[model samples]
Target: MTTPVLFIHGLCLHASSWDPWIQLFRDAGYDPHAPGWPGDGATVEASRQHPDAIGDHGIDDVVEHFAGVIDRLPSPPILIGHSFGGMIAQKLLGQDRALAAIAIDAAQIKGVLPVPLSALRATLPVFRNPANLHRAVSLTAEQFRFAFANTVSEQESDELHERWTIPAPGKPLFEAATANFDPHSPAKVATDNQTRGPLLLIASGKDHTVPESVTRATLKQYRHSEAVTDLVTFPDRAHSLTIDSGWREVADTCLTWLKQQSL
Candidate 1:
């Protein structure tokens, strides 16, 4: 039987962002589903039109939303996530939920030190306004280009922005930034858990949002884990590695890894 796959999207993107990824995995014989964050609309148009629906939602809500989806599946699915979605994949794995997981240019979590300058710049729109913490935030095309598509051409970056970018909740950003200071913060992950399934962390060398350094530090935290944990770097890619024209390369790499795990 084909294994089930779940594609989790990042901040400022709707589930539709994974449409191509869903098709790729389906062609590879996997049953795939891309569920949006709580209150995120059912479609990109809906999400864009009703940004308020996703406002004020935090990371814990997102983790539980995906967890519920996993619970209802016939079997544990392969969890694949990007950016903030990658953080969700890690949280689920910490709970020993997925059969295997992939985190691509994942956002930083607690214990990750020395926040990257680019990452901070990328998140400035949200943190700049204190009131944004309780509201939905949208990014300008230029901001999106800088954070996600710097490695791609201007026209392609604009195309990516029109197709995938959308308003996202700002609460999660505040939560992640303050997680280390809060003992009960939901952004904390149990990296030492022995049962966390085989995990792969993919880093994009040119990514401005979640750089290689953050990914390496995240991997370091898992060094004590008994589970199989690996890291791979795509030197020419940016944060848009999973959505840009060269997404197939990232997908193929993941498919190869999944097959190696015999999932």
Candidate 2:
């Protein structure tokens, strides 16, 4: 039987953002599934029209929600996640819930320090609005372009914004940002769990949200782990590496890596 794969999207985007990736992995003979955030609208248009559907959710809610999906699978999945979803993949791996994992341009967990200026700028929309902590936040085309599609063409960026962008709960962002000080935070991940399966951290060179530097720092945090941990850097890609016109290239790269692992 083919091993199941779960594709998790980052904030402000729905599961459909992984449509191309799902098709690519399916063709590669993996049973791929992409589940949306809790209460997410069924489509981008619906999400944009009704932001409250995804409002007020925090990291724990999302982690538990995805865990339920994982539990229903026939076997522990090969987890693949982007942005905040990437962080959840790491958390699940720590819990011994995945066979192997791939995190692409993933958000940082508790121990990752040295927040980059670009990353901070990208969060300004949510951070600047204190009320956003309890509400969903939507990105304008300009903000989306600056954060995820800066390296793509303007036309493509606009199209991406129109097709995939939606409101995201700001609670997760707040939780992640203040994790270091929150003893009960859900943003923490056990990087040293020897039981954790192999993990591949993919970094986009031009990503303003999760920079290569941030990825390198995240990789360093797991140096003491006995499990196999790897980092792959795409020097020309941005945060939207998984969805841009060059998405097939990223998908092929991940497929090739997984094949090498015999996954």
**What TM-score goes with each of the models?**
0.98, 0.98
Per-candidate Cα RMSD to the true structure, in Å, reads: 0.9, 0.8
In model 1, what is the error at residue 196, expressed in angstroms? Answer: 1.9
Q: What are the runs in model 1 whose C-alpha is more than 4 Å off?
A: none
The segments of candidate 2 whose C-alpha lies over 4 angstroms from its true place after superposition are: none
**Model 1 agreement with the true structure over 14-60: per-residue lDDT tens digits:** 89989988998999899999989999888878889988898999999
Candidate 1 has an lDDT of: 0.92
Query: Deviation in angstroms for 261 in model 1?
Result: 1.0
lDDT of 2 by residue, 73-163 (tens): 9988999999999999999999999998999999988988879999999999999989999899999999999999999999999999999
Error of 1 at 161 (Å): 0.7
